[model samples]
Target: MTNNGNKYLAGAVSFAVFAGVVGPAAAVSWTPPGVTMGVPLGAAFAPGIYVSNLTHYGDGPDKSITADVPAFTWSTGWKVFGASYSAVVIPEVLKVQNKVTSKDFAGIFSPLLIPVSLSWNLGQGFFVSVGEGIYFPFDSDVSFTTSGQTSGWAAETRVAFSYLKDGWIVSANTIYGVTTADDIGRRQPNYFNVDWTVARTFGKWQVGAVGYGAWDLEETVTNAAVGKGHIVGVGGMVGYDFGGSKLLLELTRAVEQGGATNYSRNDTHVWARLTFPIWKPAEPGEEHTALK
Candidate 1:
């Protein structure tokens, strides 16, 4: 809401799915990136319920993956330790197809839960926040997760910061994740991703450059030769507010890649997000800060 009388939400949720293949035909991935970008973390959403649908489609390395992720968020008027609090949950679906044949290969469910998120507005347009997320695999074929099977749980800790003032926004978020071993004792490597966004919102239109870097810190437990996967990409983002709803579109192409088995080093990602409020307090002003 760039032009909503200089207003912005305190915190919300966003998500996507990634499946890459770089050098070899190895394993599959279910890493969802870009959850807390394009907004100030220290701001507050009006105390109410909001929902979003995030879609990610990537076609590369002989395969294509499409993920439609649905999320529900609850913004509270309550505050703890001088920060606004929120919670979110996402239940996602992953569909994979062959690029050449255009036929379905695999599909499964991967879900995420963020029971805690807090944002702190530090005056002068500076905001910071912290959150924790848990990911679960409902099926063994969940995006063909991990080296072999995906029967264990995973945890992620993330932090976000932003500076929003005068229609200008500079924001960044970090994610560090660790996964437990599968049923067969095969563990996916620990991973880290950083999302950086810089945009200017004017007259209900927002445009900016967005980029991210993702790296797997350890090799697959059973594949000693598979080392790790790492890639970086930069792209453009455009957003517009239509009445009470907002839509954001982003496209990024990998500019660097190396040492990956199931990760496509050279890949492109097209992500879209649609967000709107499901319900809100009648006197939003009493529970909402409106803007940071």
Candidate 2:
């Protein structure tokens, strides 16, 4: 793993310099692009529609960009409801350039993810959530791997806490991976991540800062074979909430790469997302309705 880290660092530097003019989209956010993957546990599920794009670079075999949509569902009381479907698609150019020749690659390989998670309010602004998910490689190319790509299963778990004070809010979340594509000969190791966000609102405008970190518990790849890797990222965002609709724009940078320097070796990534209410709101005269 040590050797792989050194090699990855060298490759990462060369790649960064070669691609010197780091594009605007690359600095969008330090976290995963979707609201589902970033959602805090125990939050009420409000039916809505969301669209997002996630692009990753630096790692030789791990470079990819995926665009996705999240379809939300809610149960009565909203206390114990779950999300059923979520998916993503990758454009063609990225597939060809990265030598991601195979559709059956591992580690951020799939274009879609189906997650089923439940959130519960523990009272007093704190909450707990737990869920499971599957990664489906619907349009992958098996022969794309020059060294052979890996495609298989991935399992995830999430836990979090959130608080609202005055007009400001804060949330902390942690995600853990138990099993993945390792069965298919890929070294996808276990990992844990923490995400924190501080937000406030004024009029119809919402603003906030997001900070997060990740640690690899096991080294499934050579670069991560030794001690776990660490990564710290921070970004700022502003959004508009129009009673029933919301749109947000964000910019983030990776300030530190602890061990996965080869994997997420870049200094920054740019991102943005737009979300809309797919469901009609209750009549203005109606009170805030709670769905179970």
Candidate 3:
């Protein structure tokens, strides 16, 4: 099989075995920031843990796949050059199963690292951010030659915009990712992904609708046309904030997909974030104070 075909087959088998694990197509964007629009206050930092269970029912030539992922993330922010900068690190483990091939794959995958991000509050409830990250495979067990895996090293750039005011929030995030060519001289095409959310907050609870779409930006090494690999998803989200922590639940259905793409027809996600102040600026009208 050509590298492009192998990549697609790997995705198909991934969905068939692990029920749609968090692969390249799904991991391009960061989690939604919810209703917050401005930079973090008082030296914000947090260590968060997340667990997601996903099951995918394939269309076309693929079968069912289910997988569970447990992740640990550390996020922190600081002010630099009058703008807010943040960093995040996430490590995850994947446990997956393929019913069609009667095969099971379980191991750690590449960790996601976003070491640099800058944000600005543009006033009038508008905010913007830009960042870059990389997916570097450290686990030898995770390989493109594997039934449920694809390309090794990949890099991504992300941009986001949000408006928040009067208990209403709207945001959009977009990412562009490029994968390195494999040993076989086969390369997966570059891809672009975008996600949008609109939500309203009532007291400590927020409800909203979310949608996402992804498409290839360039032709495959085999000359397959760009845009032939695409997927669209729509879903609802509900969340609650408890001062120092937040919990969110989302359920989405894949409304459209191309045969070459590896995506589930449906999926559910849950996220929990816990934050605490590690440093704080001096109070208004106060003299210079060290972080406390």
Number of the predicted model whose TM-score against the real structure is largest: 1
Superposed model 2: Cα runs more than 4 Å off: 1-41, 47-115, 137-150, 182-184, 220-226, 280-292
RMSD of each: 9.7, 8.5, 7.3
Native-to-model Cα distance after best TM-score fit, residue 176 in candidate 3, in Å = 0.6
Q: Can you give the lDDT of residue 79 in candidate 2?
A: 27
Q: Compare the candidates by lDDT and give the number of the best one.
A: 1
> How far does residue 245 in candidate 3 sit from its true spot (Å)?
0.4
lDDT of 3 by residue, 1-292 (tens): 1232222233321211122323222211212211121112212122222222222222233323232332222333346665566665545444444344555555545566878766666777677777788877443333332343444566878787777667767777777777764433434556777777788889888888876777766533223322346667676777677664455555555676663444444433332333333333343222111111
lDDT of 3 at 101: 54
For each candidate, how many residue pairs have backbone atoms clashing (under 3 Å)? 10, 17, 7
lDDT of 1 at 211: 83
| Residue range 1-292, candidate 1, lDDT tens digits | 1121211110011111223221122222335545444544445566788877888887676666777777787888678898888898878766666454554544456577989988887888788878888887545344323324445677888787787778887888888887775545544567787788899988888899888777777764223245676667788999998867788898887677655334455677888988888897887644333222
Instruction: Report the candidate with higher lDDT, 1 versus 2.
Output: 1
lDDT of 2 at 117: 53
Between candidates 2 and 3, which one is better according to lDDT?
A: 3
